[model samples]
Target: MKALVLAGGSGTRLRPITHTSAKQLVPVANKPVLFYGLEAIAEAGIHDVGIVVGETHAEIEAAVGDGSRFGLRVTYLRQEAPLGLAHAVLIARDYLGEDDFVMYLGDNFIVGGISDLVSSFEQDRPTARIMLTRVADPAQFGVAELDRNGRVVGLEEKPEVPKSDLALVGVFLFTAAAHEAVVELKPSWRGELEITDALQWLIDEGHRVEATVISGYWKDTGNVTDMLEANRLVLESVESRLDGEVDAASDLIGRVVVEEGASVTRSRIVGPVIVGAGTRVSNSYVGPFTSIGANCAIIDSEVEYSIILPKASISGARRIEASLIGHYAEVTPAPDTPKAHRLVLGDHSKVQISS
Candidate 1:
């Protein structure tokens, strides 16, 4: 079986960051989200992989290269436009050819990987298998409805009135049978051929469609809140290691990993924090669940629960919290000025002044 990774999305939700960089390349614990999916695929023992890319094709290609870095041989399939998930499969037909394949969304994060799911699918050889997870907001995702026997009886894409709380996780297993389903289905009202529709077609035609309700952690890291949450989740498992230099004036608290060439002086870093290689943290407070990316500088600042990307500089800021700072960005206090309240007096208006 081969692996098909869908890395070609507009990523409209993560804009202005997406405007500059590919969403799949966004780092979680200093590792690109796409890299995690690729590594998982390699670990699953599938080396012949195809990556579907969009207009940001050059960037994706540059980052992944021949995929040998991850111990896999890659083939890049370009999609001129991101019509839909089904469209991705439609274009990748040649690369996927008669073999069963697993489709993983590039921006999604699954903590434990999908090796088990792939193993189960290979054993049973279902026409199509989807991973489902109970989500609080089923309306935000493609939801599935199961019958009395736990069979996938219905599928809906972002339904206004969801029939179940079981949302579709980003990982899917499909046999050669799915290629016919994609061709037979028509585009949805949204003008895109959604993969949900293709699965629904299989369900309507009495094909064997299976579902696995995931109990492990899974997140679609599309927006800032989910991105930060994923960062926190990945960091929680980090082991404590001080591979870098630390001055006597610096105090390290809980679990922290200071990579080689990183230095901490007169700063206090609490547990579950990572100071990337070549980074310098001086006279600062690095609190929990914060990942400072490689070669960054944090001076005279207090940051917590934030993801600072590579080469960023944060100095003289009072406090930074719950933020996703992009690469090479600078976070510093604004020029100090007097605080005053100015009002334009209007006719027949009453105003009070406090001094």
Candidate 2:
């Protein structure tokens, strides 16, 4: 079996950040979300992989060259536009010839990888298998309605009136039968060949389109909230390792991993936090659930539950929490001066000034 990973979305939801970087490359615990997927695929023993690349193709290609880093031979399939999921399979037809394959969405974070999912599919040899999870807002996802026997009865893509709370997780297993279904598909209302539609066609044709509702943690880290949440979850299992220098003035609390060359002086770091290599945290409070990327400087600042990208600097900032600072960004307090009122007041508006 092969693996097809989609790393080609515009990631409009991540906005300004996505404008500068590929969404799949966004770090969760200083590791690209797509890297985790590739690692998982390799762990599943799928060495021949196809990565569907889109607008950010160059970035994706540069990061994952030849896939040797992940112990896989990666074939990059370029999609000119942000077409639907089935469209990815359509483009990867050559790479994914008649063999069974697993399709993984690049930006999705699945805790405890998809090794078992792949194992089950290989053992049972389902015609088509989908991973589903109960979500609060089924309307926001491709939902599946299962029969009383827990068989997949119907599937809808971002339905206005969802029939079930079981939302399609980003991992899917498919055999040669799915290719036949995709060949006959017409573009959906979104002008894209949604994978959900292809699966629905398979269901109509009496194919064994199976669904497994996994209880493990899974998140589509498309937006800032989800990104931070995924980061928090990944940091849960971080083991305490201090390869860097922690001075006597610094207090390192639980489960903190200070990478080699990182220095902590006159600061307090409460963990599940990771200070990346060459980073220096001086006279600051680096709190829990934070991943400070490589070579960053956090001087005289208080940051917690935030991700500071590589080379970013935070100095004299009072507090920063639940934030995602981009690379080479700066966070510092405003200049202090004598208090005075300087305003162009609106008409008939109340005003107050501190002197």
Candidate 3:
């Protein structure tokens, strides 16, 4: 079996950050969300992989070059535009030729890997297999309706009134039969070919379309909140390690990882927290679920439950939590004049001013 990883698409939801970087490349616990997917694919024993990339192709390629590092031989399939999932399938027809493959969404985070799902598909040989999870907002995702006997009966794409809460997770397994369905699919009302439509067509033709309802954690890390949540989830599994220098005045509480070359002086850190390589935290409080990236500086500030990307710095700030700081960004105290709120926010960015 092979793998097709979709790393393309304009992540408008994570704007400002996505404006400069691919959403899949955004770090969760200092690791790219896409890298987790790649590792999962490798763990599934699928070495022949095809990555679908779009405008941010250069960035993705630079990070995942040759795929040898991940135990896979990768061939990139370029999509001209951010069409749709079905469109991605259509473009990857050549690379995925006649092979049963798994399509993994780069921005999605599944707690447990898809090894069991792949094994099941290999044994049963279903025409297509989709991962489903009960979501609160099924209307926002492609949903599935199952019969009483646990059979997938229908599929819907962002329904106004969803028939079920079984939202489609971002992992899919498909035989070569899915190619014809994708080729025959028409554009949806949103001017894009929908994968749900292709799966529906498979059902109509009496081909076995199986559904695996995942009970484990599944999150589509498309927005800042989801990203931070994913970072926290991954950090939960991080073991305690202290390779870096910590002053006697500093207090380390709980499971914290201070990478080599990192320094914490006269500060307090509550984990699950990680101070990346060459990072320095002085006279500050790095609270739980916070990931301070490489070469960052945190002084006289208090930050918690946030992701600080590489080269970012925070100083003299009272507190920051549940935030996603981008690369090379700085979070310092604003000028003491005027006591007014100042924010330059991106589209879809949310801020709750606690004044």
Candidate 4:
């Protein structure tokens, strides 16, 4: 079996940041989100891999050249336009010929990996197998309805009124039979050939379609909030190590990792947190669930539950929390002014002022 990773999409939700960088390359715990998926594929023992890339193909190629670093031989397949998930499979037919393959979304984060799921698919050889998870907002995702016997009987893409609360996770397993289903599918009302439609076609044709409900953590890191949450989740598991220099004036508390070449002076870092390589934290407070990327500088500020990208700086700010700061950005105190209110008086003007 081979692996197909979909790394092509314009991440409009993460604007400004995605405007400059690929969404899949966004870091979670200082590691790109795409790297996790690549590691999982390598762990599954699938070395012949194909990556589907869009116009931002160069960035993906530069990061994952030849895939030899990840123990996989990669073939890059370009998609001129992101028509849909089914369209990706349609274009990758030659690379995926005759072999069963697993499709993983590059920006999706699935904790505990997919080794077990791949093992199960290889054993049963279903026409298609989809991972499902119970979500409160089923309308936001492709939903599935199961019969009384726990068999998937119906599927819909972003339905207005979902029949079930089970939402489709980003991982999919498909056999060679799925190629025929892709050809038979028509574009949806949205003008894109959704993968959900292809799986539905397989079911309509009496081909075996299975669903595996995942109990582990899974997140589609499409927006800023989810990305920060993913960063926190991964950082929570990091082991504390003092690989960098710390002055006697600095105090470290609980599970903090200071990477090599990083320096901390006249600051207090309360962990479960990480200070990336070459980053400097001085005269500041580094609180929990915060990750400072490589070569950043934090001075005279207090930050908690935030992610600061590389080469960024935060100074003279009192406090910042739950923020996703972009690369090379700067945050400093606003210029101060007199406290007294200034108002221009007019003839017979009615006004109320609070003291």
Across 152-263, the per-residue lDDT of candidate 1 in tens digits comes to 9999999999999999999999999889999987888888999999999999998999999989899999988888899999999999998999999998888899999999
Per-candidate TM vs. native?
0.93, 0.93, 0.95, 0.93
Instruction: Provide the overall lDDT of each model, using Cα atoms, as 2-decimal numbers.
Output: 0.88, 0.87, 0.89, 0.87
In the range 209-229, model 2's lDDT, one tens digit per residue, is 788899999999998889889
Residue 214 lDDT in candidate 3: 89
lDDT for 350 (candidate 2): 30
- Cand. 4 Cα-lDDT: 0.87
Model 4 per-residue lDDT tens digits across residues 1-355:
9999999998888776777778898888888899999999999888999999997899999999999999999999999998999999999999999999999999999999999999999898889899999999999999998888777788999999999999999999999998998999888988899999999888999988898999888999998788889988998899999999999999999889999999999999998899999999999998898888899888887888877777777776567777777777776555453222222112122222221
Q: Let me know the TM-score candidate 1 reaches against the reference structure.
A: 0.93
Find the candidate with the highest TM-score and give its number.
Answer: 3
* All models, RMSD in angstroms: 7.0, 6.1, 2.9, 7.4
- Candidate 2 positional error at 309, Å: 1.0
Candidate 3 lDDT over 107-161, as tens digits, reads: 9999889999999999998899999999999999999999997889999999999
Ranking by lDDT: 3, 1, 2, 4
Candidate 4 Cα misplacement greater than 4 A, ranges: 336-355
Query: Which candidate wins on lDDT?
Result: 3
